[model samples]
Target chain A: MHVTPGQPLMVCEHCDAVYRRRILARREVAHCTRCGAILERHQWLSLDKQFALIVAAGIVFIIANVEPIVQVSLGSSNATTTLWGAAIAMWNDQSQVVAVLAALTLFFFPLTQILTFGWLLAFARRGERAPGFRQAMVMVHYVRPWSMIEVFMLGTLVAVVKASSYFKVVPGAGIWSFGVLTLLITVFASHDPRQLWHKTVGSNE
Target chain B: MTGVVTARERGLVGCHVCGLVSRAKHVPPGAMCPRCHAPLHRRKTNSLTRTWALLIAAALLYLPANLLPIMRTVSLGNVDDNTILSGVIELWRNDSWDLAIIVFVASIVVPMMKFLVLGTLLVSVQRKSRWALKQRARFYRLVELVGYWSMLDVFVVALLSALVHFQVLSRVEPKPGVIYFGLVVVLTMLASMSFDPRLIWDRKETDD
Candidate 1:
């Protein structure tokens, strides 16, 4: 029953024993089965690398938002719209679900998550463990579910094809950039969490 | 009293705090009870069942999404329906290389890869086979991470449907693919959710 840092603590609940730190990082399993017992708890992240990724992802995100994603043509009339423009177009047409979804998943959620993660990472890098680190981490977790920009992009492609019969839809530079941006963000986000956790914990200790 | 070794004496410990019971031998030096944050014993619960259920549901949904028509169109003079592939091809023909590639990768390649890779990992875990547990976990994580990208097609559809509302001149409507694509996303997400990466370590411990 004795607890101490640097010692692997196992929890037994319902006759099951599991390591404490693993459960904390994964945040799902929290009980042992055999004889229920409390387990170890640890949470940390790396500040420096996380900051770098945030900066890179932030710049790409800004570019993705500013550039036009697709160009549409009907007869001789041609027009293009950026990420935000697409959302506005949806809202203007009364497609509230689509508009809100587009805005939140593609633009809002990601923007917030990246910015928040970046801020936390920067602060942590300065050897300042803000009391709100846990709160910020929760925000990152919540935003993770909503950051579905890439998925929205796929749905957009399907929509374009269905609409092609009525109008000529052309892919724009923004679309391509956004596509790459989606891939980059996906990779960076996945890597950032694990790396940040390592860095933050290391620095704090 | 007669000489008797109780379960607890046999290394079976129960955490009164969280009601978790496990073999005392496996308990970590400082490990606490998972449920109540009390002390722990040796054995831990396996999370494979929950993860497997999730993965199976994902696999089930993945099938219909691919086979069904993603988009349905009703035009004034013509009726041209499109699937995910047809949509990508249209982009390619239109000289929208970037868009076409994006569509191909996000809607087609990435989702398909996720399904295959995740399915493989789940199957391997179920069989309790340890080929590349760490690598498999990493792959599962990648699939979970990238599962959202499949929404690219969906976003395009929503955007176009909203923007191209000129009425008689032209209009686009949601098709079955929107639903199917949504299902794909949901299924993959479920698959990711159901996967228990800890299963990988289970095999390692057993081997050790």
Candidate 2:
């Protein structure tokens, strides 16, 4: 069986003229103003780049969860907690809502999104079209809001400050790592969407 | 009633791109034309109302978030209560200035910035103004991106509260600020969601 690569095609709304991706990118306007036809719209990223980013993000994510996020000390006592520790603590405190929210938003959702994106991109790079491309894309959209590590981080900071009067507080290495991870996820996720869409749907256009 | 059918009715003049009404008749389907390629719809779905609802909720929550206590810590048979700012100050006193600053910025600064920036954007779009389209979009993205950092304060509190729960020696309890902080997070997220990106483009188009 012969497999053909997906090529970029732009269909004009007004003139119905189809232009190649390169041609559309060079033009100032993506659509014909006079006839109201789409002058340019095409896929932009290749499979290799998508897979590389997914792998890099996954490694950072693991580091974020495993390391100590912050350390606290009261007189002679000191302790540290990782991302998982925070989740477990919340559950034990009977704040099940907060615990579940923290778990899903900070850990579970991001993990699932990263794994799914990586699996799909890796498979697609090898010329094997993954089943349920659209479903995976929808899952990405759903998981996007639940990736709340950054928010959780901020809340932790506030809580630490408020608690400092009685105890000494220190930001652990995990805090810094988590910050880096947050930035990485934001930038990578934004870029990844465009790349993924291009790989999956732009090729067909 | 007695007139003959025109060429326009024969799909000759209809828009070739979006399939809207056109004046010309028998315009070849493959032929590139202006009207046929125009956008089918450019407006957002109830943009103003949605933005207002989000902004109002944010404004309402912003109050309790600052007023309520975020964490309560007990140590050496003494109970010391503090809010978000006090926490930062406490960290500063402990020589953890860097961590203090981070907490302050993430918990206090970022949340306030989200409210101000989002409120401004919402108002600007409602007025259909064309000022600072690119800058506004950047601000919006920044707010959305940083909104989650506020959770740090909550996590730290929960963690400390758990670790220090050593019955007579020390115990830390979550203050009312946890609820407020959670509200702040939700409100900010809602604010970001309510402000439509398309509004930025719409105003830009109007200006152009």
Candidate 3:
């Protein structure tokens, strides 16, 4: 495959058919000719747009970590827990592996995503490439599937349903924050990874 | 000679990163994709070995996950410890049939089905049995999609443990079973990733 400076060679991963990459007009998408899988979309958000989303996600993530997700009051006494608190409570109860996984999926990976993307996008916005940007992009791809905030939130909903049968489960600031954060993360992740890699790395390959 | 042509017949290998078909003959060994820098692999390295390892690990974890208590609730000097199956039965007894079904399918049915399906696919591939190739591929896709939902039970335990505390009067906490169960879910997902779906197509050229 002779990849000229502008015309890059593309292969369909689904069907293994090679084709010359073509430019697309705004709102146009390139699909694999053999398998009909989406190859690339033209109208991707700019780096600054992605940066704005990252900032919003970062704020919500902080709130979700700090505030209580739910508070339960039975008689005179009450109990509340933030996301980390839940993981720690599991740790104290001898379920150490689950606690560690909870922390990694819910807290660690998402924060790493935000920080890595924030740095890369900031560099791209300034028309400059940061050192290790390629590595960061790879990290983002690997981390995306492992970060299970949406799944965790759904689990929280199921927990709430289970708890609602026995006692009053008051929704707290953390739950709302987590909801918003999950949405933002989805929005952030939905963009085509190929396009982002192209913009950040810039036709260098 | 006018029969079905494979990608290898045309010297084409798909780029896993950019989804582009490139001529395999022209690319030297260990060359990166011209469009994207991802390293090219004809098939995932050590695909079968890795898949088997992960599958066995998941199977081992499955034992403790189902046998032990997932969560325990202590209320007003009374105690109840619920394993995955017992928890489903408790939900059914309480007349929350919908929740019971959901938990049953997500927790019980999904894992078992995944194990059976993946094991079958592995066997068929190893034996070079070209039966229902397309359906088998679709089944693999289903296994991938349904992988995360199995975590529902674990999340429920975490949520309840965090919320339900009555300072000496009542308490709820996750048990050791959940940790093992969580491991089972993750290990299976990793096993799926280690599998190469393209291997399913490779059989077509060799058989039938």
| Candidate that would win on TM-score | 3
Runs with alpha carbons beyond 4 Å of true place in candidate 3? A1-7, A19-46, A126-128, A200-204, B1-39, B92-98, B204-208
**Model 2 regions lying over 4 Å from their true place:** A1-80, A92-94, A150-190, A200-205, B1-43, B132-134, B201-208
For each candidate in the order shown, give its overall lDDT on alpha carbons.
0.60, 0.62, 0.78
Model 1 root-mean-square deviation? 9.9
Evaluate model 3 with DockQ and give the value.
0.40
lDDT of 1 at A54: 73
TM-score of chain A of each: 0.69, 0.69, 0.89
A best-first ranking of the candidates according to their lDDT comes to 3, 2, 1
Candidate 2 residue lDDT tens string, A1-205: 0111354433332223333445434224464432333344443445687677678778878887887876777667777788788677767765565666677878899898889888778767866546765557556755777677666655555555544555687887777777777676665654434345444432332
DockQ of each: 0.16, 0.21, 0.40
Candidate 3 CAPRI assessment class = acceptable
Share of reference contacts found in each model: 0.20, 0.18, 0.47
lDDT tens string, model 2, B54-171?
Answer: 7678678767767777666666688878787887787888887888788889788988898789788777876877686657766776887677777777777776766566677788
Which candidate would rank higher by DockQ, 1 or 2?
A: 2
Residue A164 deviation, candidate 2, in Å? 9.5
Q: Write the per-residue lDDT of candidate 3 for residues B1-208, one digit (tens) a residue.
A: 2233445656666666555455665445577766556776666777788999999999999999999999999988889999999988877887778888988998999999889988988888888776887677778878877887898898789878877877667889788899899999999989988887666657455321
Task: Output the lDDT of residue B205, model 2.
Answer: 39
Q: Spell out the clash pairs found in candidate 3.
A: A10-B20, A10-B21, A11-B19, A11-B20, A11-B21, A12-B19, A12-B20, A12-B21, A18-B21
- TM-score, cand. 1: 0.60
